[model samples]
Target: MLSACFNIISVCLSLPSLSHLLCLSFSLFLAPSLSEGVSQMFGLVVSPLFPQGYPNNVLETWDIAVPPGYAIQLHLTHLDIENSENCEYDFLKVSVDGVVLSTLCGEKSFSELRSTVNPALYSTLGSMRLTFQSDFSNTERHTGFSAHYSAVDINECDDPYTGCSHDCSNYIGGFYCSCQPGYLLQEDNTTCAVNCSGEVFSSLLGSLSSPSYPGLYPENSACSYSLQVEEGFQLVLAFEGVFDIESGERGACVDSLRIRAGGREWGPYCGNVAPKDPVVTNSNHAEVLFNTDGYGANKGWKIKYTTKAKTCPDFVTVNSVLEPKRPVHQFKDQVRVTCNKGHEIVIGAKAKHHFDSWCQKNGVWSDIEICEPVDCGPPKEIDNAELKFINESSPTTYQSQIYYECEAPYYQINTDGKAQFTCEADGMWRSSDGKLDIPHCIPVCGRPSNPLESIQRIFGGKPAQLGNVPWQVFFQSPRGGGALISDRWVLTVAHMAQVDQPYIYMGFLDARNLGQGVKLEVEKMIIHPKYKRHLGDSSQYNYDNDIALVKLKGKVKMGPNVTPICLPQSEEEGQPELGKIGFISGWGRVKPRQTGKIPVSPVLLYAKIPVAKTQSCTDVKPTGPEIQKEKFVITDNMFCAGMPGVDSCQGDSGGGYAFQGEDSVFQLKGLVSWGIECGSYGFYTKVVNYLDWIRDTMAANED
Candidate 1:
C-alpha cells in the first residue's frame, strides 16, 4: 500500500510539467508568428449601428491558462483608429481563462492596450479564454480579428453554454443551446423568441401584418382570439394604427365595436367610444390597458370595430379597437348642514361650487364663508352747515365717516344745536350746517380774447371770453392757475408759486411782447386752506381738502372781453359719471416728454385726455403687501382717470379738469392736485363732493 501511494504522488508531481509541454507544442504551429515578435490585434469585430448583435456572425474563442505565480506578456496592434467615417463601435474586451476581465471604449495605441494589464493580476489568474465577439449586428461588410500567442495554455470549458436552461452542448471551441421558458431559441440562439398573452399576438412582436391600416382594412388580414381566466381577471391590451401613404385618416370609419365574454355579449359600440374624449391623436400609438368587472367574467371574448354595411374597406383593424374601462365617482350623495334659523349660511359654505363638501357643527363658517344682511348707514339732517344725526344704531366698518361743517360766518358749529358732536354708534355725525364759508373772494384776471374791436386790432384779433377759456399770461412760477367762482377769486394750486416770491401779469397775452401788455404785481395771494407745498400723504391718493381762493389787488376790466366762468352748482360733490371729455392746457413745458431741453412756450397747448375707469388704474399697479399698505387705498371720495399709454406732464398741473355737463355746457370738473411720476395716469379730486364747502368758503371770504 505504501509503494502504490508513492507512485501516485510521483505521477501527480510531474503532471503540471507534462501539461505545459503539450500546450507549448500546440502553440508552436498556431502562434509561430507571435513567437517571432508579431503583435496581437484587438478591436470591435463589427460596427455598433445594428440594433442587435452581429447578424449571422460567429464568435471566435481562444483559451489561455497561467499557472499561479506566473504572468504572460503579449503585444497587441490594430487598436489604433484613424479618422474613419461612420465610426460608432462596440467595446473591446479582455478575459482571463473563461472569465471576462474588462471592456474599453473607442481605440487606443497598441502600447496603451497592452499596458492596461497588471502583472500582479495576471499572475494570480489560473486559466482564461479570449473571445472576439461581434457585440453589434449589421448586414454590411464583415470584419474579422485574430490573436497571436507566444507562450500560453488555452483553457476551454466542456460546455460553453453552461447554466443555460435549455440543452447546452459543447463544440470544438464554443457551446450552443436554446433559452428555456417564455422564450424559444432562434436558428441562431443569439436571438431569443418572445411570448405574448391575453390577446391575439403575432410572431413579429411590435410590428403588425394587417393590410391597408389607416384608409381601409382587408378582411383576410383581420384576426381574433380568446382567453380563459377566473371569474374576475383583468383584460389589458395596447395597439397602434397604421396609416396609408396618401390620406391621413384612420382605417375604414370604425362605425361600431363589440366585446363578448362570460355568457353575455356587450352591444356593438360606436367607433366614437373612448375613455377620456375618444378622438385619436397623431402618433396613434397605445401603450397599456388594464380593466376588470366592466367585461364581466374574464373568458374568451372578441373585441372588434366594424364599418357601415358595404363600405369601401371591409373589416376594421385591432388598432382601432381599444380596451374599455369603467370610471369611478369619488363622491356619491353628500349633504351639508346650515347654521341655526337666526343665522344665514354663505353660498360657498352651504352649497359648495367645487370639491363638494358638507359643513358640520363644530366647523366654523367665519374662515370658510358667511353671509350677512345688507345695512346702509343712518340718515343725517343737513341743516345749513351742520349735519344732525336722527338715528344712531348701526356700526361703522371700513373708512366710514359722516363729514361735518358749517356755512359762512360760522367759524365753528354746534352739533345738535348744543355742541359740535362726533360720529355715533350707528355711523352718524352732527355738524353745524354741513358747510364752510369763505371770507372775501379775490377777483381772477381773464385773458383778452375778444377785447374791444379797436383793442383786438392792436392785440392781433383774438377772443377774450370763451366760457372759462384758458388765456396766455405771465406768472413767475413754471405752472399756471385757474378761476374758481368769479373773475375776482383765482384758484391756483399752492405749490406753483412760493410764498416769498409771487407776481402776476394780468393782461399779458403773449410772453414775446410781455412789457408792452398790461402787468400787475400780486397784492394778497391766499393759498388753499389745507394746501401743503410738499406732495405729503396726498401722494398716497389722499387729498385732505386741496382748494384755494386767490384775491386779486384790483378788478381792472369786465365785459365779453373779460369775464369769469360760472362755477358749477355743487362744487365739491362727485358728478354723475357719464363719459366726460375735456382739454388740459399748461405752460410748464410744451413737450415735457422730450429730453432735458424744454420748449419756451408761454402759450398753453392742450390734449384731450379721456377719463378712464377707476379699475383700470388699479390693474396696472404692481401687486404686493408693500404696495397695498403704502399706496393702494381706494377711498370713496377719490376719483381716478387716464389713458394707459398717454397722460398729463409737468406743465399740466393746477390746470382745469373740464367736462361737458347738463344743458349743453362745458364746466370745470376738478383741479389737478399732485402727482409722483410725470406722463403716468393722473388722479383728480371730485369737485362735486365739496360743492357746499366751496360755496360756503367763497361766501364766508366775501363777507
Candidate 2:
C-alpha cells in the first residue's frame, strides 16, 4: 500500500541566497478531503519535510475511519513544531465527527493541554479528522509534528458511566444493558423490575410460582398471585417447589410467603421448610403473597391450587344482630345485619339503616359497618346571657332544647329574638343555617336617667330651673333643640343639620344662663336617610324620619346635671299605647304663640302630653298645596304625642319627649318633628322604631 500520495515541486533558482530569503511557503503537502475519506487500520501522519521545517501559508487535513466495534487511538511520537502559548499559528487541530477533541501546536505535549474532557489520544466515534495549518511567514525553520493512529476495541463494560441492572456487554464501539431471567428492562433501558405481581389464575386447577422459581428470587420484591373458580368451588393450595426464603433466628420470617382465602389466614411460612399439608380454603378464592427483603438470595417457592366444594363461616359483628339467623352459611348465599332499635350505623358509614353481607366465591363478608347510639354533647355557653335547658329533664341528646335569658338593667337579647336554641341531628345546638342561634346580650337601656319627681315645664308649659330635664340640648344658631344620648352625641332633628359652626347649650333649664353648664362645639351632623326635605318646599316636607345626630367634639364630663339618656327597649318596637303620658320640653315658642315672629321664651318650659291615637293625627291632616297627609302618610315611625293647643310649637323641633318607666327612670320616647299650627297637636318621630338604627349609628361612629 505504498502509493505515492503527492509530488513536491521545488525550484532551485535561488539556492545561493541567505536563509532569510529562502521562503518555502509553497512547500506543503495536503491529504485527501474528509468527503473522499480513508478507511485505514493504521496510519502515520507527518509534516511535508520529515526532518525539516514545515512550510508557511499552507493548510492540510486528513480524515481516517476504522472498522466497526473499534475506537481510533492516536499517539504523537514527536512534536517539534514552532512554539507559542496557545498555538495560535501553525497548529494542528484534531476532531471526531465535528467534536473538537484537541488543538496542538508549539512545543507543548498533549498532556499539558488535555484534562479528561478533551482527550487527544482516543476517539469512540471510530472516525477522526486532522488539520495542520501554517501562517504566511516563519521567523526560523523548525522540525514539525508526527503522529501515529490505530483502531482498538472499546471496553465500555469497565466504564463507570455505563448503566446496566445486572449484566453489560461491550463490543465494537458500543455497549448494551441487560437483565437476568424473569425481569424486563424498564423504559430507561437500565432498571430491571419483577414481572410477577398480581397475576390471576381463574381455572379450576392451576399452579402459582415465585418469579424464576428454579433460580434465586430477586431482592426487594413484593409479589401476589390470586386464584378463583366457580362459585361453589373451594381452593386447596399445596407447596411443591423450593420453599427457601430469607430467614432470621427464632422462627422469624425475614422474607415471607402468606396464604389467605375466605377471610382466613394460613402459615406465614419462611426459611427452608414448606407447609406440611395442603391448605383447605373454605371458599373458591385463594391469594398468596411472596416478599423478599433487600438481602435475600434463595430459590423461591411454588404452589399447586385446586378447587373443591365450598363452605362459609358464620358472620357476626359488634353492636348489631344478624337477620334470618343461620346455622351455617353456604357459598352463593347471603345474610343481612341490622343495628338495634335505638342504635344506628353512625360510625364510618354512608348508609345508616343496615349492612348486607354477601357469601361470594371467597365467603368473606362485605359492606360491614359500625353502629353507635346518637348523642349530642353539652350545649354551648352564652357570652353575656344565662343559658339553661328548657325542660326539667336535661338530656343533651338529639332534639334537646335550651333557652337563653339576658340580664336586665344592662343587657337584652339581640336580633332574631329567638327564645330557645335546639340540639339538632348533627350533634350540635344549631339552627337551620347551622348558626348557634343563641341570643347575644346587647345594650338594654333607660336605667341611668334622673328619678326625681317632675316639676318641669317646656311648652303650653311653665318654666323650670336647671336639672329638671337634664338631657336637654338647645342650638342657638338654628334655634332648634335636641337631647344628649351619649358622652359625645346629641340626638336632634335632621332639619337643623345646616347650622354652621354650631354649638349646643345643655344641662341648663334657663335659656338666659348661657354659661350655667356645658356649651359644646358640634363636630359633625348626621341626617336621617329618609328625611323628605328633597321633595319640594319646607311646607311640603314629609318630615317622616326627621331624626339627626350631632356629634360633640369631645367626651362630656358627666356629672349630676350632665348624664346620657339611656335608649329604651319596648314591646312592639316601643309603640306608645294610646293616652301614654310623657313630658315635652324645649326653648320653643312660648309667648303669644302667633305664627309670625313669635319669640322663644327666656326660660325652658315643659308640658305633660299624652300619646294621641293614630286616627287623631290622620283626621287633622293639613288641607293645602302642602297636603301633609299625602306627603307624610303618618308612617309607623311617627306618632301624635300631643293634643291641640298643648303640643310642641315653633322652634320646638328636636325637643325630647321623655317618658318615665315603672322604675321611675325617664327615657326619651320621641322627638318633636312637625305640626300644622302653633301649640296644636303635632307629629313626632318615634325613637323606639329607630333603636337598631341608633345603636348601629352610634357603634359605627364610636371613638
Candidate 3:
C-alpha cells in the first residue's frame, strides 16, 4: 500500500500543470490515514503534498513501528528539496526507538539507513520516527525525499559479526549470550572467562590448585594452567593432597584434571587416592587442565611442580691414549684413541680399543677401554758367561731389540762375538740363531767333532728342521722358492717374481704342509730392469740380472721360524772363492728323470755344490746350440754351481745358494737362475754383482 501511494504521489508531483482540485483529490486518496498517525508495521514517508512548493515554516513527522523481534530499515529513493551544504534550512532527521540514526538535508539522497543501537544500550524496541522541517521561505522548492521503511526479522545468529562469547540467539527484537558448560558469559555478553582465577604460570617451581581448593569446587567450572621452565630442565608434577573427580567407564574421568607435557597426555586423574609418584616430563613445558561437570566435585587437586636439571652419569677414565680425551661435557661429542704397535686391546674389550667413543646422555662413553702391550720377559741368561749390554738399554717390549756380548772364558759366541735378540710381537724372544731358545754361547758354529752329515753326494735330501734355515721361503702358484731378506722384502728370480697372486710361505720347513707356515701377501714386485726370457730358447735368455725383490703387504713378525738372513756388506763379502763348497736348498725334486722333467718335492732338500769358474762352466756339454753361443759370453754376474748327478732342479730357480762367511753368519751368495738338465752344470745369478741395485731398490720402496 505504501509503495502504491509513493507511485501516485510521484506521478502527481511530476505533472505540475494538473488542476489543484485533481491534486487535492489524489492527495486525499493516497495519503495515509490521519488517525493512524502515519505509523504502521511497515510504511513509507515523504515530504508534504504540495504542487508548487512546500509551504514555508512547515514541520512534519512520521513514525514507523514493526513487530517485536524485528528491525526497521529506511531507504531514501528520491530527495530534492533545498540546496544547502549542511541542510540547515530544510532537513530531515531519523531516529529509531528514540535513538537518532541519521539526519539528512539539502538535495542529497541516501541508499540505506538501518536501525542499529549502541552495544552498551542493547535494546530491541522496534519503532522509528522521521521528521522533516523547512524554514519560512518561498523561493525554491522541489519534490522532497521519499524513503521505504520495513521491519526485518533481526537474525542475530545469522551475522557472524555479532559479538557473542559462545553462542548468539535471536529473540523478539533482541539477542542474548550463551556459553559452553564450563565457561561463563562476561557482563558485556560478548567475551567469556573461565570460572577459576589463575590461568597460566611459568617458573622453576610452583603449585597448581583448583578454584576454591581444600573445599569442593563449584559445578560447571573449568580452569587451565600452563607451566614452563628453562630449556634444559624438565617439569615434574606431583599431587600434594587428596584428589577426587567424577569417574566414568573405561578409565574416563569427568570433572578431571589432565596434565599434558612433552607431547604426551597423562591420565585424567579423578579419584580420592593420589598417584603413587610424581609425573616427569621429557621436555621443559607442561600444561594442566581442570574441568568440572555440573555434578559431584571433591576438594580438587593441588599439584606441586618443580624442575630438574637433565644430567648423565659420571664419565669413566680409560687406559689407552685418547685422541680428544674423555670426560666430554656435552652430549653427542666424540673421542677417538689408538693403541701403539705391538699393543692392542683384547678381543671384544671396549670396541677393540681403537673405535670412536661417543659421549652418551648418561654422561658415559659409548665404548670401553682396555689396551695392553705384548710382554716378553727379561732376556735369557747364558750359563758360565756374563752378558755385556751393547744396546745399553735393556729392552723387553714387543718387537724391541737388544744387543749383548758374552765373556769368552768357558763359553764361546755362536756367530759373531756380538750377539743380539729380538722380542717378537707374539711375546717370544728370537735369538741371533733364528730360534726361540736363548743362544748357548757355546763353541763358534758348534763345529761337529766328526763330519757325520755330508752336504755333497746326497741323491735325495732330507727335510730340513724348523729354524734350520729360517730365511728360506716357498712361493705358491707357479711353484718356486725364495729367501726372506727383510721383514718386507723377498729376494727371488725375476721369473719367479712375475705372479698374478704371489704368496709367500715361511717359518715351516716341510713343503707338504705349507699352510702351517706364516703366509704373506705381496704388495709390490720390483723385477730386475734388464731381466728377460727368450721364449722357448733358454740359452738366449739373460740370466745375469735375474734377481728381483718382492715387497709384502705388511711387515712379517720375526719369530723362530720366520727370520731375515744377513745381507752381504760388500761385493767381496758375497763372492765365494772358486771350489769353495756352498749350500743350496729348495723344495724341488730330489733328482730329475732322464727325460729332463722333475717331479714336485714335498720336503725341503739341501745339497752342497762347489762353485766353478766361468771357463770350467763352458767346458760342460751344452744342451742346445743357444747354450753353446751363450756359454762363452758368461760375464762376472753369472756363476756355475753343479756337476753331473748333483744340482738344483726344476722349481728351484729362485732358491738361495748360501755360504757361511768367515764371520760364521750365512750370507746369500747366489740365486738359482737356470740349468741345462738336472744334475748338470747349473748357472746361478751372482748376487754380489747387483747388491747395490738391490739395496737401492729396497731403500726407495721402504715404508
> Per-prediction TM-score, please?
0.30, 0.36, 0.36
lDDT of 1 by residue, 329-444 (tens): 11121233232222233364343212223222212111333423222234344443454333334332212344435443312233333334333322234334432231122222
Off by over 4 Å in 1: 1-474, 506-509, 515-521, 533-543, 559-561, 571-578, 592-595, 598-600, 618-638, 644-646, 662-664
RMSD of each: 33.9, 22.7, 21.7
Better model by lDDT: candidate 2 vs candidate 3? 2
Off by over 4 Å in 3: 1-460, 533-540, 593-597, 622-633
Question: Which ten-residue region of model 3 has the weakest summed lDDT?
Answer: 443-452
lDDT of 3 by residue, 186-232 (tens): 67777655577456677889898887678877665667787877665
Tell me the lDDT of model 2 at 679: 62
lDDT (CA) per prediction: 0.39, 0.72, 0.69
Which residue pairs collide, candidate 2? 69-172, 457-605, 457-606, 458-605, 458-606, 459-605
Best by TM-score: 3
Deviation (Å) of 650 in candidate 3: 1.2
TM-score of 2: 0.36
